[model samples]
Target chain A: MFNWKLLKTIYLYDGTLNGLFTIAFDCYIFKSIPSNIIFEDNYISNFLDTAIYIKTDNEKSSRIWNGLYNNVSYDTLYNCYYAFLSCQKNKEINILKYILKAFIDGPKINTMLHIDYVLEVMKLRKNVLHESHRLKGLTRLSEINKNLFYASIHPDNNVIELLGHFFIKRFPLQNLILHDKNRNLLFLYNSQNPNNYEIISSPSNFNISNYSIEEIEFQNLWKTFFKNISIKERTNPRLQMQYMPKKYWQNLTELK
Target chain B: MDIQEKLEILSDAAKYDASCSSSGSNRKNSSNGIGNGDISGICHSWGADGRCISLLKILMTNCCMYDCKYCINRRTNAVPRATFTPREIADLTIGFYKRNYIEGLFLSSAVIKSADYTTELMIQAITILRNEYNFHGYIHAKTIPGSSQELIDQLGKLVDRMSVNIELPSNDSLKLLAPDKSKLDIVKPMSYISNKLENNQRLLSTFSKKRNFSLSPVTKYQKEKFVPAGQTTQMIIGATPETDLKIIKLSESLYNTMKLKRVYYSAYVSINKDSCLPTLDKPPLLRENRLYQADWLLRFYGFHADELLEEKHPNFNTFLDPKCDWALRNIDKFPVEINKASYSMLLRVPGIGVISAKRIITARRSFSLNFENLKKLGVVLKRARYFITCNGKYFDKISSFNPSFINENLLMLEKRSTPSKNNYSQLSLFENSLPTKGDVIKCLTGNF
Candidate 1:
């Protein structure tokens, strides 16, 4: 039998999802078959006799990404991207590599079964679905001074695209911002200001206390109304906890 | 009284009616009004108890001419009462709406002076909100039982929904408890509104036929336009000794015949010290919640009341929920093969809710699913473990398990702790029966 050490290869790149995806694309395009795979910063086995490190190339990565979009269906690319974002262990990368390898082999290979990869993709789909539902209930909008509506959210998944369907159709005229604090992602859709954003390490330190007195009064009235409407006879904390979990209570306006 | 004082008294009085949902209506803004009742609807805020507060749940007046023993605003109660003029209530609703404080108005009233008088006052408030203030937001008005048909017909056009409370399940209990209210009086107004809505739908359909291609303006305005959200009724549970079986049967008939959108079950809270009612220390909220779950099974899960509960077992088991209890009773239906079982069969398993059932169906369409796949789909196999099988093989703990033993074990696992507060404590009307400070903690967390 061939030596296992000669078959193994190790690749190092930026820890971000995009960077990892680029390496995966290069491995498929260049047909580099490795017995084992590990991330850049992770510890390696001392028993291995050989390990080849490949630096990620931006030009090759772009060409591969373009080929994925043009040659394969959009759904294929979406599934690959989602599987990458799931953040499963190193075994997941192997499964994803297998799926990409099958795709690159031929069109008939697309029908082949990769049970582990499909399950990983389903888990990622569930995360996206949950974040979308939570955003619908958790997004709290406040009127800013310039007649625009703004809201902030800290979600576990990158759900910026999911929130667009709800806010754009409902409030067509108003400008809005859906800030994901956990991921440091901002999705800004304003007719006056062209749609774009940059990742910030932390939310802006702009103080809301200095806003107009009218907004303050409105918040007070809403809190008072929320307090008065809850009937003591019908209090069910168990059910309440299920619908609005404690983890999200910190950001909800009505909860405070 | 000035508007503010009247608002305080009326709103405080109307706070107890728990039918504040403003969903399922699709009314839009018209040329004559300034507001629109949104289709997806609006949720103003959630209460401390976590119930959605969609409307300003309030009464026109707490002053009453009838003595309903279960009602806090009965005629003989020595509580301060106030009434809001149509203009005052309308202005308050507008002020609240403009400030994003409420979705709309949920206007109710105890019978003040007479049924006609109360109904007329409610009509005046809704009409002013529509014609004068140009407010087109949601309005859920309560139809007084003995009100005239003309008044009911008039109010139906201006509001989104109407409800006539069928407080007791049976006519005999209604006569004994609420002497002023009668079954005939309640059913009469409901029937009138039902006929009017049907006629409006027919008239609109016929007018559209005459117009050939486009919908006529009159047809568009009048087409099933009254109470487009339909109607709902509330029944007080545990007040008149009606069994869960009988209550559920009544709910099914109401849904089948009357076409009611919802039948709310309010657990009886002893708000009054009348000799005719029981003196329960706390409301049967858990029972009410169980009934709602059973109701969901009836409507969505394709179950009849008789199928779930029988005359011998009239009341639901307080320990286990209705679905779990049903599953235990029908143990032969267990060990459903995940890969081959249909959607309905999958739903019968304990811990498999509507969402999971649908997901299983969809996921299996692409490829055969096993136990591992079911777990990934979010099926709670902890409860469903004994019910489902994978590839014709039973899993651990489920294989060769006796049905009776499993049923007994489930019953024991579901038992709740008994309430520490004497459940038979005498109710005091003026003094707050609700616990205070440390006592409150015991009241909330103590076993019931």
Candidate 2:
């Protein structure tokens, strides 16, 4: 364990929400502010500086979470969580600044959107949520092996948790497994554990789950319907690309 | 014909409908069913034309008896016509829904045999989807204008929403374009559906055990079920000489009196070479978009249709959006204080949307907001900076409220946001079409 008391300029963590929160807890306890925060995988020893390595502790993170929940507005907590979900580079520093501001100015710091850190966090949260909402609609479920409904998406943000909660309410009885292949996150939900889904992370490891015969036939039918539905005279691909961009077409059943 | 071929013709025919929204309906999948209606409709895919395909918008048949000149499937046209069996439609809907290809079904038909027969066929197809299949998904059915009230009532009870197209804006346009459709024949079903929805709400309010059922619930035990998503209508713009003033006035009446959920404006596509219809290479899409913007002003923004347009200025300006145009005309309301403006006043600003306005209201309660705060609150500072003040300091260098000065600068800002039609640039070397907003409006009016 690298000594956190050395007063490092940059703190490195494992790039988890809890890890970020633990770093925030250290900043408060040490009464020293770190200039930069980066993920552990991104950290390289710069001979000009001291480096502090922090391990994730759920207890410490939850303590900070509970403190915010009791002190600040619930909307602020959600904002912080959503901002953390953003795939933007160097988001750790943005979220850390927001947390520090939240501590200094009380819970109402979120209302001060003119503050650079608060505004950036808000923008990042909006991006995360906007992509989540789009994926909820664009998510296509296919049946695989016995009864599992499987879907794969490659959203910019880690939105599988958001998509999982949406599908759980939408299809409460069905077994579901949504894989965010971009982040290698797997969300598994069954009727037995419908409300609290089990999320696991690994490499992009799942094969195409052995699609049922009906699934293949229906996907072909969907492609047929997608082709037949468009008007020949009014074909405008620009508009379609505007709504559903080409970047999102790789995993889409109809587009594929 | 097989199902695939019939689907091609029917889906092609149904593309004219702008009522593709499956919103305002909520339901749960039944024990045996495979689907339910989403509260906010989901766009499973966008079509090549950029329209969202929320529902399986298809017609029961392309067979028609009436000779409406604007219609692609008019009786006079020699296009190959096809019809889908009720079983075929039901099968297609279920098959597609299970695969997540659609939210539900938007089943419509041309006048088959008679109005009653066509409506009955639609009802039969929907009935199979609802009763036989136990499908609880969103179903938006089109009511044949002159259908019997009994059939309309049966149709309304089965689906989540219904519509009766008002086809033309005025009686004269109907007389000229669709000699077979009388004004009475079209409006009768609209009134019937509107009255039925009101009655259903009243009965539910009085007798419903759960008054918290603001969200329409599809339970087997409920006694009454009307079109919970309500009714919507569409009018073919640019097909007639009706001005924007006339179009919105009719829309206002429909919204105010008939209790319509929405009024769709479809830019008229010049399909067949008819002497009555205007010749156009493309539909008046930008004009249609402008009318929709004005329509939003009426529905949500608390602006009257008269305020947006009147007899003096019968049409909307092609370059500026309606709200910005309204704000420019009402310059006296400008320079509203960010910390002091009312919600309505804040909403009237060009770049300040509903979300930003709400944020402004809430954020100001904590501190007196400044220009930086306004931008941070999601206000489009470029457009909004002219109309708003923070701490009594003007962001833009403007001493006068002259509309043209502001209008010109605002157009420059708008020009950045919307791509200028390069189609004009390509034609400029050959034809000296003046590149002005007026010329755009003139071109929109079919003067080209």
Candidate 3:
């Protein structure tokens, strides 16, 4: 007979949601108890049970990821990642474990609405969706050159991947680079050429001189235009600060 | 007068007019013009004050024949008057557009000669921008009441947007203050534009059926469409003895009856010391902001003016935002279960905005949301705490708290004193510390 306390073993894995799912799958398949579990890299465990480092296999991870994608809605995959990115607490792991178990049980799992964990995951996903939409309107781009549109965003979440769909659709013909300087990532889309992107840990030094004289002239012209429009009679510094916060102005070319 | 001096005087005189928004129209560059209205335009620069400076928002002339009590450029005032010729004004617009100095021109005028004459000059300036200069950008023209319907119709086709200021809410107030203006004259031009737009739309839709071939690529009906961005009117708040409820109701009627794109409320700043008007120490800016918030609720939040401020509670609570005030009044609707509530129900909560409400709706489709998860989703629990519950579990509440008590508590919380600066010596360290002559020039011209 298994002692419930002794049988319970805490599983720790990489902080990624995929790593969490693999740990959950191993515990379930082997009939081993998950006493108190956490993302392996986050905190040191106090449990005396045996520690196992469950490696994240690309094939198995892709199989789980792709299975969720093909069987479930894009929203489900998005929510799972959103909940994963939240870095909330151990509950997030349990939620992910429930999702994996349902997926392992086959396509029928998508129909169930009784699970509270699924709802919480969807909430996190909705937040990421809202942020992506806001970025479309609020992402103020500066003209670096005639062909290049440069914008730097310091988003609270990893929304760099999400913004690409909007930029691609809006400025289809223009060559642009949307740099997530916080994440050190770039999405380069050139109109005359096919679209291709790469994750660079350290991008080469940028030179402002590479911009055309016309582009530089237009930038100055735009700045001049912005300066002239403010009405002195209705100057409300309080309202101005509210709309265009001081922290955002640091990156805005017009503010400079 | 030379164009430069005339421009300076006219632009300075036009400064008092607060309707400078250049959004809504999505006109693009055609074969006829060098400019494109697709871009957000030059007035994108916001000042230290909340006003957006996009257009060279100036009048064609400030030499008015009428003596409106609320007007700074009224005939009685001893301010220098100037008028810009159509050619000079047209040249200024094109030059400014080329330099990216302004998005376009907001050409308003005082009753310089006659209503017809002033309207003619404004039309002439816009015609040059459209036909001669081939500049296709955002132009917001003011329709002078009593101008010919033909002139109004002609001008409507050329400009992107137009406005007819209702200056005062009631006709009685109009007679008391701006005696020269009449409600019929104001409503007449708006009716003409609305009819023209309706007629143009009907003509375009019918043309597709009339022709044996597919829809015409270039229809005359499209060019004749009146004010593509529609009309907006301004009302002077706190100028007359009208209550806040009266003003909001007027705005609602203007939106519903007039089908206005926007109704700008210019807080009465006491620019002119006329015996008829109130002598306020400062402009009721906070009140204006509250009115704007209420206006936003009316437009976006499916709220009526009466719901926010009733006949008894005519004035909005100065301390709390309009939404919070509304929520406090309806305390019986409090502690709405987040998981079970509808999208509209979630939106009614004080702390939850449109975005957060939408998130709650979509998220609850899959899971029952709790308090901690709601906070993570960026819901303002401080204000919403009294209103919403997570899975039927209440977090915070003063059980016996009445609306007045909540109002007082919220008012105390809202009392934020702007950090006082001690010394003029620290001024140099900050950017835009003092408005220099250069800063004024840049603010005026969109050139820094």
Candidate 4:
């Protein structure tokens, strides 16, 4: 009578907010929880005997997002987007499970920390927010050209967009580009229109070594300041490495 | 001297000042200015010693007339001397700031000729940065101890924070080590700045329209022109014979009476071999860390200095943090119910930090929390389990309600909890080249 395989088909899609939302929209229409949901890049051939590729539909995804805003709390919808940005495996399925639970449990589900999935979303959001906050201090801008600053970062999470608020607020009149080398994305902020920031695909090769004369001089001064500030008696490399991890020293002006 | 050489000596000399923070001020940039002083200061980088490099911390000059024996730049020392003109200081700050190199300027100086002259030079440096350069960045300038009332008054209006180093713990220590500096010279400026800040707030609330922060004679009744982020001071510990009781009491008094924002405790850094000072192998950094923790208790937690240490227990327990040590002595306060305890009570419990206590209060409003929920709320259950309960169920099996019993377990836990100073995780100079996606995923989750 009943076939378990038919109902348990898992779906994988291209990794984007639109792609995840489309899958959620399908699950909502079907009124059934799939076996799993994941990104297409992470899809592994499994014995479940079914794999569906869902093309990203902008209209369908927008409908799902609007439906979420109308039904669930705005925080839950926002948290879903941020959680998807996490590079963690199972993050997509986790968000899907949260969405499915929210659809069944009602709008107040976001406030319930005792629920495991809701707590996981909160944890992942904190990780992303912490990295974004740390980068505000760690990012070192080098003036590559006349009045154009270039900074490169290889953050664990995709936090290029999140760093826009801090740099823009601090340098509203300066041209800045924050290039995320790992993810091949660039956040460009033009001084003329400081209100908006555009994200674009980064070129395959970008040179960070070419710097203006003033920038090279500033880097030297910064390096001098960095070298002299430490006390000779207290040489705790462990303590130094504990706070400013070694992995982040690659593009740091003082470290380089 | 070249700018690089000047920067090296001045920052090296200024390293001992220990007030590198750029927080507590929210000065916005002028619509046409180059920068804004953030309310929550940002650290641009960490130095080799791992201390934060928030501001471009530097001395105006490293040549001093008064030979304070603890100082490296005292009159008797054989060291290279350098000084930056006010214009050079101003230009360097703005140049480095535009390239995203620093938060702002933390300008201090040795007594070049006199306290008044040094203070005036510092004021001129800040004035140039603020007016000529049109820079609106954070400025933390050191107020020379015995500067004139006019110079001090003019100085406060131009900077975000001002500090006068209370170099020693007691008047006796002041007399013994640094004969050139006096207690009144250090304290009078602190009191003046504090009173001015208080009076400024009172006047601001009382007379909103008559606010004139211009030159003193512009308005009949001068409005309060003061340091917006407030004033802080520092004292050298282990250099003097004063007990921890004296240091903590001084900090508590400074906090309550002078209304000082922060009192930095500098352990005796033995840079000079003066016959008047005792020789130490190293700076007492551990004791300094303990004092900072105790200071946090005084400021944030509802604990007084006397409560943490009495006449019999004059010093903190070196093995345990000040809070946990206090908890063990006051064993009657243990086993606090997580659901029923007040915020203050919850904060008193070890391993439940301010964030977790607030989380508990927020989460408790929804439902009665269990142990698992407490862990999810970021409570370090390994340490908190012995002290807290959920619905009258203790997560860990309890021994007798004995002080020594709990203290024994805590001492063992303390040894295990702290990341070993020698064996912390290391990142070699170039161990990681390019992380794959799986490694990126782990790192994103805070595992890598």
The model with the greatest TM-score is: 4
Listed per candidate, the RMSD to the true structure in angstroms reads: 9.1, 6.0, 11.1, 8.2
What DockQ does candidate 1 have relative to the true complex?
0.18
Each prediction's TM-score versus the true structure:
0.73, 0.86, 0.66, 0.87
Better of 1 and 2 by lDDT: 2
> Which ranges of candidate 4 are over 4 A from the true structure?
A1-14, A18-35, A41-81, A96-111, B203-225, B397-400, B416-448
Write the residue-wise lDDT of candidate 4 on B22-48 in tens digits.
888877665457788778888888877
lDDT of 3 at A55: 83
By summed lDDT, the worst window of 10 consecutive residues in model 1 chain A runs over: A1-10
Each candidate's fnat: 0.24, 0.52, 0.27, 0.63
Models ranked on TM-score: 4, 2, 1, 3
Expressed as tens digits, the lDDT of each residue in B1-448 for candidate 2 is 8777788788888988988898998876654456777777888889888889989999999999989999999999999899999999999887777656788999989998999999998888989988987888899999897889999989888899999898799999999999999999988889988998888777765655654664554253243768988999999999999999999999999999999999999988888888999998888888999989988888888889999997899999988889889888899888788899999988889888888898998788878988776766767787787787888887857664566878888887776677658645544576865689987898888544
lDDT score of residue B192 within candidate 1: 77
Report the C-alpha lDDT of model 3 over A137-198, residue by residue, as the tens digit: 44655556665666776665667766765555444545667776665667777766545654
- Between candidates 1 and 4, the lDDT winner: 4
Per-residue lDDT over B111-179 for candidate 3, one digit per residue giving the tens place of the 0 to 100 score: 977999999989988998889877777899999988998998889889988999898989899999988
Model 3 segments more than 4 A misplaced = A1-234, A245-256, B1-6, B31-43, B98-101, B197-213, B216-224, B396-405, B416-448
Lowest summed lDDT window (length 10), candidate 3 chain A? A1-10
**Candidate 4: DockQ?**
0.47
- On lDDT, the candidate that comes out on top is 2
Model 1, span B99-147: residue lDDT tens: 4456689999988878888999999998899888777678999998899
i-RMS for every candidate (Å) is 5.1, 2.3, 6.7, 1.4
